[model samples]
Target chain A: MNHRRKVTVGGVIKYIVLVLVFIFLAGPLIWEISLAFKGPGDNVYAIPQYLIPKTPTVNNFVEAFHRVPMAHYFANTLVVVAINVLGNIIGCSMAGYAFGCLKFRGRGFAHGLFALAMLMPTEGLLVSTFLLVKSMGLTNTLFGVALPGMVGPLNVLLMTNAFAAVPKELIEAGKVDGANKWQRFVHICLPQVKGTITVVGILAFVASYNDFLWPLVALSDDSKYTLTLGLNRLQGTFYTDPRLVAAGACISLIPIIVFFAIFQRYLFEGLQAGGIKG
Target chain B: MARSVTQPQGRGDARNAPSARRHHRAIDDDGPSSWLFTIPAFFILLLFVFYPFLNTIRLSFTNSRMLIPGHWVGMENYVKLFQSDQFWTALLNSSLYVVCVVPFMLILPLILASLVAKGPKIIGFFRTTYYFPVVLSAVVIGLIWTNLLDSRGLINSIFQSLHWITTPIPFLTDRWLTLFSAMLVTIWEGLGYYMIIYLSALANIDPSLYEAAEIDGAGPIRQFFAITVPGVRSTMTLILFLSSASAFRVFSEVYVLTRGSGGVGGEDITMTMLIQREGTGLSARTGYASAISVVLLIIVGAITVIQQLIVRRGDD
Candidate 1:
């Protein structure tokens, strides 16, 4: 009885500590939201910095779109992300299916190479990647921005693991039914890993949307800038007005957050499997 | 998007003697259809990954500027790269940033994960809140923090009102403070990612072990040290290697914070940023930047090897 009482007190203390830590971790984002909604007339430099506005306005959001081609940038980012998602789905899935279910002479070797590809950081290859795009005449285009990243090593590994989790008997049954290798994969193996495919899609979506350095290097003109580069430009343009920068940042974070919430189950499963890839 | 068949829970190889033999036979009967399926990935890999990897090595030996290849410089660029003072400073700054931040990146999240593991009812809320910062773009995080710690930004605004410092401190502009601030942002953004990883590791530990410890009157801290620590030992090692690699490659955060010029007073430049400034654009020194990259890769690879040896020994 005494031990139980002690645990209750300990539990209460733990809750208080965790809640405080949570706020500290989440405070800046909340601050971004509060500051973003403030009207331009609001005195941002005033002491006792305000958390909420006396009258919140959409003027900052309006200003964010007006000062730049926010709409065109948004459309441009979507086109690139859409193309990347499509490319990774087709390419990574085909590769993952090959390695996962099919046993070939060099399956282990090819898979090992794929894993090595994932481990090797992109820093060493940036110069050639840039030169490759230029040689292909894709410099300063959205397709060029999406091309190098179209098939991720991580995505292939993810789909392979997901498909491998399917029962061996299922594939064997398809083989007995006179299905060819491709038919067995298409008819039998591919359907089971749909959740995993969604997981790969969500990962690709976030990676594509949040990508910075490559886009910065690939696209030179303002018209081709993604949302990330556009927001980056705002740091200089909105030099005096920090409120507008916060507003632009807030707007850009919305789609990814929505994707995260809607596909959370797939995301968590992918994250669990992700530790192995790491 | 297509649902062909649904298997039951806990699906794995169903052991039937007849089917097991047939499975092996079927695998042998399939020609090289597997390679056909892999061709898409291979085509992209040839153009993007493998070619680029080999090209980077070749580029280090030539004085190629922009896109055109030039005469072979052999060891000239490598010699200059080693002799450059700026390269050494960037390397030192990167080493300092890693040393200062990687420990916190692993341990702080671990402590938070243990906290998250304790509460059942509110676990979902805390988990989401902690992960919020990680999903955000580095540009957003860099901008937000740059503003937060700016001279007239949120931190200084509060400081002035409280009568702390009459003059706003230079958080982003100062030489030392600038590098320190970059680490601060990196650590802050990294916490959520590692916390979630640790939380998953914590979930795999047997709950009965803790219940048994409680039966013998072990406190939470003791249980954490004795049970939780040992259980997640592999995860800690994994994070240590990963965070070190990322810290060495730190680029976008510094890029946005410094407004895409070089680092503040050139003191906050990391290996990736140094490579970018030297290797890209019309005046690019392809050979010099490639030499720097080779050095960076060698360092990262050495750490990985050392880490593997240490992990293997620890396992034994």
Candidate 2:
């Protein structure tokens, strides 16, 4: 009976700690959500710090949209994300298949090139990359924002590992049936690595959606600003009011949350299979 | 193809036998076509990644402006960089960021991971909720924390209501306080990410070892110190390197908190911010910024090399 009490006590303590952590981690988000819905009549700086707005409304959201071209920014971000996802899917998968399955000369050299590219800090190369994009006449363009990150070395490697794990028997069987290389790759190898493909797609989407630094450097025009940049502008403009800023932030965050909720399982799996393992 | 059909071999011996070799040669004769597959990716990498890197090095020597391609200045930019007060302050702030932020990142996440590693069905829910911050853009995170740490914000308001102090803490106004506040944001944003990495590492540790420790009357704390610490040591090292490197290159948190001013009088600037400030805009000193970029590269590269040496030493 004493031991049972001790176990229960331990479990209770564990839960207490967990709850504290939850409050710390998710508190700001909840506060932001509350703040976004707060009407002008609500005292945002209340002494007790209410987690729910007394007079809940969508005025802040509407105000945020008016202050910035929120829908235009969203549409621009969507285009950039689509280009990135499609580019990474086609580009990385092909490169990955070549590296993983094909026995070709200078393969080691090609792989080394990718490894070197992976290690080059994007922060360090911001200037010259901007110059390159400018020289290509793609400055202030969505394509320029999407171009540099479209085929990341990490994704290539992730897809390579996935392709390498495709059973040899399957490939051999396809070869026996006189299927060409592309035929075998598409029919045999690609189907086996659907999970990795989804993971790659999700990763590409998140990276592109959340990207701010490169876009800041690439596009100088306000009309071409992505959601992150637009929200930053909103914050800069509306420094006095937290409500509109919160609403702007929420606008940028909701899609990511929805996307994450749908595909979070694959994300964790991808982290295990690709990130740490590599 | 005929040879593969006639002399079927096991997967293991296929690499060794001459017949299997012949079969592989016939089936895997995709030399030129394979090169075709890799072309598109390499083209992008070369154009965007490789060329720009080479160009940055070359541009550092020239007195290049944003529009006009200037003549070679021969280390003038580097000389100017070393003499600048802004460079020194930025370097100091970035170094201080790594020092203050990395320790919390290493420990907090490990503890968080252990707490959620084993539990009831609700643990999964906790894990998912915790990762919410990681998925949010850094801009959003910066906005969230900036409001919370504002002078009349939720935290200060709560403290004042409780009579903790008369005046609100200058979380984003004071120079050093602002730097530390940004570091706090970094840690808060990173906790879930590193926790996920730790969870994976924790999963790899042998369960039998824990059972053995339990049988020997070792308590949870004892087992953690003896088994768990050693088990996740490599992961700790990885987190150490990752956190430190990221801390050194921190931009968005400080950038957003200071509203792109890099604190009052630009006292809390970072290396990347310095690069951005100099290298961008119509009147950008591209040459000088390239020089800063080169310095940034060297420091980050040194960190990586030092980390490798430490890992090798630990292995030895």
Candidate DockQ scores, in order? 0.49, 0.48
> What does candidate 1's lDDT look like per residue over A1-278, in tens digits?
23433457778888788788787778888888888988756777778788887668999999988997778998999999998889888888899888777776667667767766776778778888898999999999999999988888877877776666678898899878888887887888877888767767777777788889888888889999999999998888445588888888888988877877887656655554452123
Q: Show model 2 residue runs off by greater than 4 Å.
A: A1-6, A273-278, B1-28, B309-316
In angstroms, the error of model 1 at B48 is 1.7
Instruction: Give the RMSD in angstroms, all C-alphas superposed, for model 2.
Output: 5.6
Off by over 4 Å in 1: A1-7, A275-278, B1-28, B310-316
Docking class of 1: acceptable
**Candidate 1 CA-lDDT value:** 0.79
lDDT of 1 by residue, B86-128 (tens): 8998898788878988999889989888887654567778877
lDDT of 1 at A26: 83
TM-scores, chain B, all models: 0.88, 0.89
Candidate 1, position B127, lDDT: 77
